[model samples]
Target: MDELKLGLDLGAVAEALAAGEITERQAKNASKFINQVKAVHEKPLKARLIQSDRGQFLGEAHPLDCGAWKAYRYGPEFRDGGKVFPSLEDAEQFIING
Candidate 1:
């Protein structure tokens, strides 16, 4: 038998172990690792850089901004408190157009 050694190869093994075969310890560890990976990838959206007569500003490219813009533009509190967004497409439009 070939003993292939691997370091931190929990992703594949944890997924392949299946529900019945995975022990409590493995489940806990796998969940932790998976969450860590998720957090690492959950980077914030890029900020929009603008230069105008007023000078430069640091703006964000996000749905909340778009929602607020929409609300302000159309006179409706649609994206209030970050609770609602019709779609990212609408949000993205504001980001680009503004």
Candidate 2:
């Protein structure tokens, strides 16, 4: 996996903690901070949309089928799943624009 460019200097913080320069509490706090930073950078670069309940849109995690994209909503409602788009472009366009 390629390294994501997170602004948090996790290496220096870990090094300082290991060298006894920072307390265990400081290290723990730093770990928590780094996790937040990691989450921001770890988000998908593209083609990943957030799932919303009361929204009128489709997510980007759809599957390709017969040159068309099929979207499935996993919930108690919608027994047969969601709608289908004619192409991947249609899926992404609807995902972002809608």
TM-score of each: 0.27, 0.35
Clashing pairs in 2: none
TM-score attained by model 1? 0.27
Candidate 2: where is the Cα deviation over 4 Å?
A: 1-7, 44-98
Per-residue lDDT over 1-98 for candidate 1, one digit per residue giving the tens place of the 0 to 100 score: 00101233455546545645666666666666656666666865443343334654313333354443221222233234222336654544543344
Model 1 stretches with alpha carbons more than 4 Å out: 1-18, 44-98
**Residue 32 deviation, candidate 1, in Å?**
0.3
Against the true structure, candidate 2 reaches a TM-score of 0.35
Give the top-scoring candidate (lDDT).
Answer: 2
Error of 1 at 57 (Å): 33
The C-alpha RMSD in Å for every predicted model, in order, reads 10.1, 8.1
